[model samples]
Target chain A: MALQPFTVHRGVAAPLLRINVDTDAIIPSREMKRVSKQGLAAGLFAIWRYTEPGGREPDLNFVLNKPQYRNASILLSGANFGCGSSREHAVWALNEFGIRAIIAPSFGRIFYHNCTRNGILPIELEAAVVHYLAEAIQAAPQQNKLLVDLPNQQVSVAELKFSFTIEATPKRMLVEGLDPIAMTLEMTEQINAFELQHRQRMPWL
Target chain B: MAKTLFEKLWQSHLVEQLDGDAALIYIDRILLHERTGSIALKSLAAADRQVRNPDEVFCVIDHIVDTLPGRGDETMMPSGKEFIQTTRSAAQSAGIHLFDIDHPKQGIVHVVSPEQGIVQPGSTLVCPDSHTCSQGALAALAWGIGSSEAEHALATKTLRINKPQSMRINFEGQLGTGVTAKDMILYLIAQYSAAGSAGTVIEFAGEAVRNLSIEGRLTLCNMAVEFSAFTGLIAADKKTIDYLGGRPYAPSGENWKQAVRYWQSLHSDAGAVFDREITIDCAAIEPMITWGNSPEHSCPITGTVPKIDSANKKSASMQRAQDYMGVKPGQKLAGLPIDGAFIGSCTNSRISDLRTAAEILRGRTVAANVRAICVPGSTPVKHQAEAEGLDKIFIQAGFEWRESGCSMCFYAGGESFGFQQRVATTTNRNFESRQGPQTRSHLASPATVAASALAGQLTDPRTTQKS
Candidate 1:
């Protein structure tokens, strides 16, 4: 399925400074009541977002629940964000909750790939840079807006501008909303040829 | 040219080299569980795509399936029935192999794949579950993926992957008594941070790895995800060939001979160099246990938690974990009272793991105050254990001998320990609320969990073994 294209996004950047922010924390398994990816925004950060498991009452202490950051479209976090679990629901929930981009020092490999597939830009920056951005965003939660330019591979907030690195395919997928399956299916001839030889070489497989 | 085992596997599976560092890799097998399988299948159909090679795809009713006796579609997790039913119907419609709830072959995706010989050396397997890396024990290039990636693989039988750098971890010397593959992996994660092996695939090698059983190798590779590595694998040896000898899906007769010949060559050349290398002295490893949320926050079972240095950047998270776990900075993990003990999951639910735990549980009873549960990894493993009277030993020890599946390895809104309960468990991952609401899970070997349960406290398995 093709995802929504992301060209440039400028919005509120919520700083969740904890390291190793895993997918389970983003959307706990209990919150995944249904198989479908829809209706997960309520469960985004369910454990920390709510007063109790499955409760609607918000925990005012969480960064996302703060009135100033309630509409956060970008998440700024420490290293290894989206670590643990290959559950795509975490990315789906974040996307549903208006999270278009996540800036972190590093990410769980599987989670990083999931981000581009869902049109969520995962920006990897140096730890110091991510800390700087978080401190700057926290300074003026409401007024300070972060800008993410996908085409140019850059992220900026006020005078702070940093260029990030992204692979070509994922970069194109996020920018053009390309359906990866469709593109791969286009190479049917190559896949068939490879499989034919592979089968002959190892018929047991 | 001397090539690493990983490089050989990568080159053999490479369908095409795309722009950048990515390549189109052919997938030999795809494994799935009900947790995310239904979504992948449903989305594939919704997108008007068909499974390119249905026969190559296999689905099992593992995650979220009840481990209680005579369990059906109904589950403790609300609406879990829909997931099971949907996956069953979708898998059937797609013409893929389905291990339904009643299927004797049903088990955790990682456990079932290897047991059935569906995973083989030099093949590339992809699954939607993170623990899929466990199959790397068979020397297969396998890793976890998301549901969307699952759909893509089902539709194209290929994945656009950026090849990760390769690393080799050599575990030299012999392991101490009661020290196990689980301890080796835990010690590695604790020594290096959780993100230590990020952006790399590690080949666990050396004499210690060679001496471990296939199940032990699986346990060692299972938590490679915990270390944040792309995956971990070991070179195929005679032991691996012997393990796959008569597996249901493995080739037989003439094809088997050909397969063995190929698998024998699945090893890194002597002169092959890795992007990075680390050597751990197996003798130095102790029965390791996690004290905080992340698997990295671990120590020797007999050691005390280190006092947090407030000046450290990650001290805040450490403090949070300490508070959540209700443990003092310098509290000793050994003899720490636990509310529960569990031995299951892809990590330690196999027959060999059960035998080791049962050895500790023989003629011993669980503490009256602790709740202990043991779920075998698969029906075959469970049946084998039963034939060996391991179930009776576990039941006699006061541990609930339940059905096979990924039961309480994770909370998942179904089964969970009580609020703020402490547990010594064999499953991987000790993240906060992983086993229950604010539940504190200390990961260790099955022997450790069994010994700890028998003592009603975190007792070292080595101590109990000595007795």
Candidate 2:
């Protein structure tokens, strides 16, 4: 479960202004046939990415279809992004689609955790700041490239800058590229202490 | 300090706080399904990790298991048998209880949890599937976790999670005919949009929720994930007590009395504070159905597609949904011809749901042009429906009555509706390609699905009188 350490990410930011952008939209159930996270890059935003007649061809109007956004490595999203399903594949799809970070006002709680676990930095900023980033991207597409600094926990669009906050554990995990399982088991003594007491009182559970 | 029902559950389950709002919480029970659990179990084995407490964990062959009657180790999904076989072997090696395909109790994870009484009030449960929150209807704290979190909980008996904010939705008045808990939840999601409950644990309160049957409550809570909520729950009450009484996994004798007393206290205090609150009148609800991809794209069955205007904040999503569903603003959802109808899912495949649909389908025949199918939520539910002749009623109505599992609700290379077919179904999600690629899924209650099949269109069930 070791994820690639995230130090600094700088790339063109694609703007998706919709709120409550669900994981199902990121990657739908039909594309979940492969248990592993393989071949998910094509399924990213499949609904919007695919043209109607069986989705054989890409939809030209989609942001990713546009030449400028073809290399988008960062996503600027509205509030409550990644809002449904606990599928970690949503993060996998985004990673495989070349998105290294997401800047949003807020995020679905589980999706936020999943993103952090998978080394996809989900920077939570104010709604106004997110809007500024989206507008900045729209104003000068090529000049709108942004940088996400995981160690410092900050995101910047040229001179415009916004600092972000993530917990110490996830921050360290991202910096160290270590899965939390081994670290989580560090408190087994406390965990075992509670379980033994709980089992005695509620054996049926 | 007065505590919300959710707070009490969280406080009792707290093992250690990691940092800030994040805490290492003990999971009393862990339920796993073939899709996600197999991956976790295989990973656990690969890592040389053993389940911390095998007796407290259980796994079922749902999600990837074919619902076809004669289905065994074979799966409709190519290479899907590996998931089932891997899970079976992993569960055996881990010493975790396995509800195999032929296990009498084998069923959808959510349905099996409640039916087997594995979810008790005041307990904290986690499953790798989103609808695990359905068990919260029993007054327990249950929510979905990813495969990685499942592996962590299996190995350490605890998970590191940041506590969610709290919301309480109060419903007053009485429900009208054709209005069920499914309609109530759909109405909530529609009114507030799917993200309304995001990052919050929801407590469904007020007279309307209290009056619902245990099955109805489960049906309502089952869709908690649809609203982007952490989970949904109700306070333990007499109905919950009665439902859990005498089940195979429930405590007996003096332990049972003590358990009941403890559950009785697992409710919100009078002055418990909630971060958000919403009020709804139950009598105002109507049979609901989704007209488009997202569950938020739902309306009363009698209404037309919303005219997306400046007033609608979700105008962009609505427009996309309209195009994806091939509907225009002000388009009527009713009388729209459908090529298929599906009645089943963790959301609404319980015995009561089956009986409710059967009452409408008795002696009725599905339209020749529409293909309809019914899947019970669990093997026990299937058996109970057959005992009551519901299977016969469905067969007579030309609806295929299939074995219990998560079938057709999600197409992970299993049986599916016609490609790009418009199907009216009783399922939790209507995301594009959820049932099949290019498929247009209109979500509704089981009765609506059954009625739509008979008319070969998305007909409102309230219009059709019971047989």
Candidate 3:
């Protein structure tokens, strides 16, 4: 299934400034009762977002629970965000919770890939730049909405504008919402050719 | 012009070098578990897609399957039964090999793959679990993938991947007494934070890595994801060849000879270059354990919790981890009381790991207050341990000897440690609430966990061995 193309997204950004914010924290295993990706929004950050385990009561101290950030469509975080686990449910939850993009200094390799495949833009900026944008968003979140321009590869909030870089393939995929499998299937000849030689070279495989 | 082992493997498996570093890589094998595999298979079927090559795909009922003796499809994880049933039907319909719950070969995907000889040198394998990198110890190119990517690999037998830069981590000297592969990796991550190898493929080399047993090498590479690396690899040697010999899926007779000859050439050239290189003196490493929620929060057993400096950028996270663990700065980890000791997971649950722990539990029983459980990585490993009377040692030592699977590696609304329980565990990942709600996990080697269980505290294995 093709994703919703994300060309330009402007939304309220919530700050979750903590380094090594791993995926397990993004969505706990207990919250994943089903095998599908839908319905994970309630489980996003459940450990911190909820007052108790498997409870619906919100933890008022949690940033996402705050009124200003309740409908947060963007997340601003520290380095190595989504650092552990290869579960794409982390990305699925963020996408379901209306998160269009995430700004961080760095990300877990697999989670970064998962973001692109899920129609969520993961922008890597300097820690200082991310902190600056986060501060700007936190001061007056309603007025200081973040505008993510995928075509230009720039993030703008308030008077600050920062340019980011993304790979050509992922950029095209995000902008076009192209199904990667269908695209790869177009090159069936090349894959078949490689497999034929691979089988002959190492019949054991 | 020398080429690194990564470059050799990359080129060999490269279906097409796309724009920039992006390439279409052929996937030789796809391993799956019930927890995440069900979603991928269900999604693929929903999209009306068929598996390109079912012969190369293998599925196992590891994750979410209860590890209790005489276990069936019912799991402690709610609705976990659906995942198993979905994967069972999907795998059977797709005509792929399915190692069901009662299959003698059933085990964690990573453990079962290598033990079954499904992973081989120069092959590229992908799984939906992060510990898939464990198989790279055999000189294979394996890495973790998301469920969608699993579906893509299932439908096309290929994936669009951006080639990662290469890095080589060299453990130069021999490991000291009580120091094992688990300690070496923990020490490495502690020295250079968890994101030390971000965006790079690490080839663990040097004397220490080569000296490690195949199981030890697997333990070392298993935590590559925790290091934030794309994957980890080690050159195949005589040890790797001998370990794979006579395995069910390995090449036989003439094919075995050809495979061996080719695998011998899977190492990096003498003067090959890497984007980055780091060397560690293995002799300096001691039995290491984590004090906080991250793998990077590790220290030697004799070390103290680090003081939080307001000026340090990581102080906030450090403080949060400390507060959650209920430990203060300057507090020593040794002799700290523990509520539980668990020995299982893809990280360290093989026969060798079990034997290492059994040596410590031979005569001594677990502390009267501590709850200790040992889950074998695979049924075969469990049988081997029983054959050697290692299970008797574990049982006699007051530890629960359970069935084979990924039990309690992470909580999934299943049987979990009590609230606020602090555990000494051999599994990877010390993330918040990983074991249970508000549970504190101290990651360490099987020896260290065994020692902690015996003493009911965080005791160094070396000290226990002396006594």
Candidate 4:
């Protein structure tokens, strides 16, 4: 896919769904077998849906079971979001699930990087704001909307406007569609210049 | 300002300052495994580049190989098989030492590296697997990198790094009976939350750390990634030297003496400072198990789940965990049903781990409802376990004895649990869907896993042991 800077949808609200959302929870571990990112979306929540043969023992208690959350694009979660293994599959699963942004008080360090690298925006907000959004979603259970402006670092739901935070480096990379690899490769000219100087000095190249 | 251990190491590794907040750091060694290494090697080939120092690079086929099935079988997906083949070819073509499938020393990359003494004190190590930090247990500075970064490291023997702050975690008091390093780390993660060590290199110290065995130290450092720490380390000492003594790559005789002298000096100075400090009373910790999807959502095996309402009310993430884990407030974890139990992984599949499990299962049969398995970490570990009849004990106790490799953990390639099946596992990470999609994994030590397998639930090993 060609790299493109796409604007995030503004004022698109969804109910707060899924709890203890770990990286693995987003995608099943079995799906990690594939080296490349393909056919992952089909099994995004496979464990929740089909662990037992003939699907005799479906876990209705899982968040993915609730039909209302079938297409929610924005996920408002509890503290320490995406904790556990640093599988980037969690980010891929969330992207496949159509979740463009995650609003939480904090995130596991590795998960945050995976999200930013895959064009998923992880917004760190105050606990009060997260609680407010979660409570509002629960109360309405139907009409919860959120307005997220990445450029302004603000998330607005109902009458409350909560500012979010992102480190300058990750923010720049996310906004510029630059992953770590892309960022490093962007310095090709400098690297090439250094290599040329070294070759001339040592005759090794 | 006082310099933290991280600062000292970063300063020592700096080849030059590249720009603001970035530096060109010399990497002493790089380790690679089948899964991520294949991609990195492919990228290098695409760029028409060769490794700068093939001797310094090591390759091991672990993640994708089947631990239950014999070697050469294609149990993994087609792509996984392809990755393994590519890694084998790339290692040979690049003149890098390759530990192919079923090699006596082949096993979890992290476990094999330290066992073989490829990981030495004061060196900078990088791998594409997140658990690469496990090598930090040897007092080597190590961290996980992305495929692209791995490729770069291979080509230049250097990596562009941004230094991290340092945190010193000190534990006092003797650990109570039945508590292992796994319990200690679980307690730390639960108390500090998963983000507790963010942007920091954690240096474990104090009496408890000092008393742990080298293998125990490895278990403690292996899960540093669970807490989001950049890395975790314990300074090398006599115990470290003892463990490295006759390993394959360890220096010999005069060189060994010189190396020991240098390793002994790697400890933090008496007045050395850290960016943050946290202390724990090791005696207070009990055998712990994760109640929810995240490792941070853990509590003592005897304790009840935290009330959802009592969770950080401000943190939606905690509240969500309370809801998704299907755990109710005031509910004890003692009698929770488990569908499976696993004992073995890079984290706890060493000879000591097997001996502990075998001792616990000597006369008991696994619970009728619990399907259990014990996988050795490497071929050598398996051979040792069999020689001591540990595998026979496990099989007699209703546990499947499997070959050596990264099995069931990280879904590298092994049988997965049924959806929502509660599993008491000795491997690291209990994240949502970690064992399989929607499968609930509870992290514990090998002894605890054996005990739970017998009880068919989350049970403490201390209660079941006949001292």
Candidate 5:
């Protein structure tokens, strides 16, 4: 249940150019009926990738279906990626499908939180930079492997270097592989103190 | 200090102020559904973590269960029964209260929360389901989160979240006839695309908004997610307190008085600043319906489906939605033939929704060409409808009278209409194949669904003739 450490991720980047890529399309609701987190690897983008019920035949036109992008580990998506649905399965699907880092202009708030918790590094970059990277990836996916260095907060491809910003807590968590609950537990005293004040200030029922 | 309603509730519940924007906020209540909440609890159990406060948690089996009468642990979906059974075991193990399929009070988590008075004004609640924001209608701070967050809340009774910026959407003027809260929300989504309110919690103000019933307010907040807002809130007032008074789980005696006094204070102070503000004239709105996959791809019922201008077809999704919907430019939204009609889902399956549908279906019959289904939102709503003979009207009109649960809201490989069946439905979310494979669903109000069922097409509810 603990997250994998994310330090320096280098892999081929696949471009999903569509904006507002909702969690449903990432992995539809029907595929999420499984209660356990296991068996989720196949459900990642099942609708877009699978031509049949169990993904017997791959959809050739889909990016993931292309042989070159089959093992891509970096996803260069358009703005507002992972919108709609609070399902963490979206992040699970992305991670299970071999995507370690996602570079987008923006992300849904819940999806961004889930990405952090699930150990999938979400890099928020400028729209123009994301668009440029997406084109670069699509043009030469095999030759252009993106190097996402979390400690340095930089992503580089061939000759282009883009610096990104992430909050301190999430950055440290990703770099050190620290558990979020463990971090929160360290502030138990502060939490209890606040509760004591809150209850005394306003206690009705 | 002047404070907006959001800030008042937020500061009241703030537990540990973390670095920058993040904080550890305490949660008063949590409502869990069978679909996603079960996964969170199961993972916690697997991790050997204990629920911090079982009394604060309430679980219900709504999402994956069959809505058919005389149903049990069996499910139509492949291993769908596992999700329900797993949740039953997980809730029991966690010592959290479970509302099983046979529980009289069981219903959609959002409907059951306020209906039972468990979600009081000024409270903060979260659920794994996105529509958890519906509880915000009662002036509560509620929003959706992922299963992992649910697990954390179960284990800690707190969530570490960055406080969102605030926005106020004021609906001024008066609502016209035949336009309900569903229409108002649809109109809002059409005006502001789905992502308009991203990273913000919206507080709806203005006279027209306050004029809506509590149920209508619930319906209004139900689609806040469609606008990409973290949640939607309305300040609690006399109506909210009166609505909560004497409910099953509401406070009694001295507690009731103190709770009411506190809830009465849960309003935005004058001159409180918000990050953004917008105003909509309610009189300018009309009964609206979705024409494409996205909720924003909508228009007034009388308006035509838009053909994207040649210069405006840049967003492939818009063009793709129009093509998938099979509606051309200049196509009339009304009178488009439908093969089925659904009248349920947490979005619009409350008692008022059933009554509205019954009014349109009093003596009429569903078209022979259309398959009409009506699933009540909750067991209590179903019982109340039956007591009032609303069920008789629907049954007499040939609508399938179903038990309470999320039936075909989004077919989880379970019971569904025929493939590619063009249907008008009351459920939210018009995404491609949401209800069933290739199913073309036109999102509308319950009355619109009823009238459409009768006409075997998308007919304006206001224009439906009396039998």
Candidate 6:
């Protein structure tokens, strides 16, 4: 699939539940070697599987196994959403698992960049708002929905409203499928003109 | 306006200004590792362009190869095999020096470069790996680049870069006993949070930095990426010259005298200015650990999990950290049960790191439930450790003695941790799922890792003694 210009997905908000839920927890390490994203959706949370090689372990405690959250798309997480190494694969894995946006108190700097580069909307909300989302998601499990308005840069779920800030350059790039290198290349006409002029003056080209 | 160290270096390297903040900077050296080099080489091949300066580019195979059980063998995995083959071929075809698997010099790119003296003062270096800043301990300006950028650098020997503002971090007072440079950097990260040094080159100065050995300086610069800095550098000094004196690539005889004079002139002017300045009291630092998933979510080992209430006035990031780490407000950090321990990586895998771990584990055995492994940074480091009987001590203490390479750091190739395994490691980051899926890693110094491994819990090194 060709990369699409990122569009804000607006819908009823999904309630948040966990803190510090990492990319690895979203998709385990053993399942990361598929060479591509296909077939990875099934292994989203392989550590939660109840069946084992020997027999059923019956006591597996997987977040995805909970009755209410079989297909939650919006993840409400604690501070530093992506906190480990700078693996863009983590964002790819999360995006493949159907997480369209992540509302966190804060995010790892590199992970945040990776998310933006891959079109995963990471929203930074206040602590109270994150707690409220978690509580709302857990309490009413059935009717919880969050609204993410990208143009307006606001997140509204239940009675809470949160605002986020993204700088203009990265924001435009994420929404328009532009990277720094690509933007640099786009100015090649001017660069070439300057180079030609310089070579004429210095005879170095 | 006074110039910062970055400004001094950037101006000195400027071939010409390209427009606005961008410049066509002269590059002194470019380094490549397995993970990113293959794609870079393929791109160059696709472009039908040859490397502009082969003598300035160095390639090392470190990321994907397994380093357990002494040496790694060629495997069936396409990525691993391709990484090895592509790096070897690219080096051979380009006439670049190649460090292949099990070569006595084979190790983490950052570690090996400095130890072999390929990285020198007053030079600008780039690598495909983020921790390349580890080489900045030699007073070189080293930074990481993506594959595409690497390809461009390989072909042109120049990088179109936007000059970054500079930050000066001064460390005064003596570091407390058992508190390594790793602790000082971790403490800074926690205080500044992750984005504190974004878009800036950081220079380490003051008495504490002057007192650090080359290996310790490497540890300090190695974690600059954790703060999102462009790079971290120290001024070239006697310690740096001493470390490089006998290495393979150092200049000999009169050439050495000229080189030393040039290096001495690389320091910032006394009145040089910086965009930002932060001073840290080294005496105030303690052995640190990351209780939460991020490197910035660290605290002194004796500290408690930060309470949500305390973070009430802070960024939403604090609350998120509280939630993600699953710690209730005011929870103590010591004595947390650990499932694994790792004491190796480019950050803390020098001979000093191994010796520190050996000192801690000299007479004590690892706890029955702890799965611990100690990987040296390079083959020479391993050989040196064996010569000093450090490997026997590590093995006798029940820690797995592994070969050199970036084992358990990148989670590359086939090595990884079990789900939900809590690991005390000497690597730089402890982000969520960093070691493996659902595996939680806590960043610490090598001594702290050894102490934790012996106790099978998050115990302070100060409390654990061989006696």
Best by lDDT: 3
Question: TM-score for every candidate vs. truth?
Answer: 0.99, 0.95, 0.99, 0.84, 0.97, 0.77
Among these predictions, the greatest DockQ belongs to 3
User: How many times do residue backbones clash in model 3?
Assistant: 0
True contacts kept of 6: 0.04
Regions more than 4 Å wrong, model 6: A1-205, B73-79, B310-328
Model 3 ranges off by over 4 Å: none
* Pairs that clash in candidate 1: none
Error of 6 at B351 (Å): 0.5
**What lDDT does candidate 2 reach at residue B2?**
94
lDDT of 3 by residue, B243-343 (tens): 99999999999999999999999999999999999999987899999999999999999999999999999999999999999899999999999999999
Clashing pairs in 2: none
User: lDDT values of the candidates?
Assistant: 0.92, 0.86, 0.93, 0.75, 0.86, 0.74
Q: After superposing candidate 5, which stretches have Cα over 4 Å from the reference?
A: A53-55, A196-205
What 10-residue stretch in candidate 3 chain B is worst by lDDT? B458-467
Tens-digit lDDT track of model 6 for B170-240: 99999997899999899998888766786478999989999999999999999997777778999888888
**CA error at residue B206 for candidate 5, angstroms:** 1.0
Interface RMSD, candidates in the order listed: 1.0, 2.4, 1.0, 5.9, 2.0, 6.9
For model 4, the DockQ equals 0.22
Specify the poorest-scoring 10-residue window by lDDT in model 6 chain B. B70-79
What is candidate 1's TM-score for chain A? 0.97
lDDT of 2: 0.86
Please tell me which model should have the higher DockQ, number 1 or number 5: 1
Arranged by DockQ, best first: 3, 1, 5, 2, 4, 6
Better of 2 and 3 by DockQ: 3
Per-residue CA lDDT of model 3 for A18-82, tens digit only, reads 99999999999988889889999999999999998989999999999999886789889998999
DockQ, per model, reads 0.81, 0.51, 0.83, 0.22, 0.59, 0.11
**Model 4 C-alpha lDDT versus the unseen true structure:** 0.75
Point out the higher-scoring one by DockQ: 1 or 4. 1
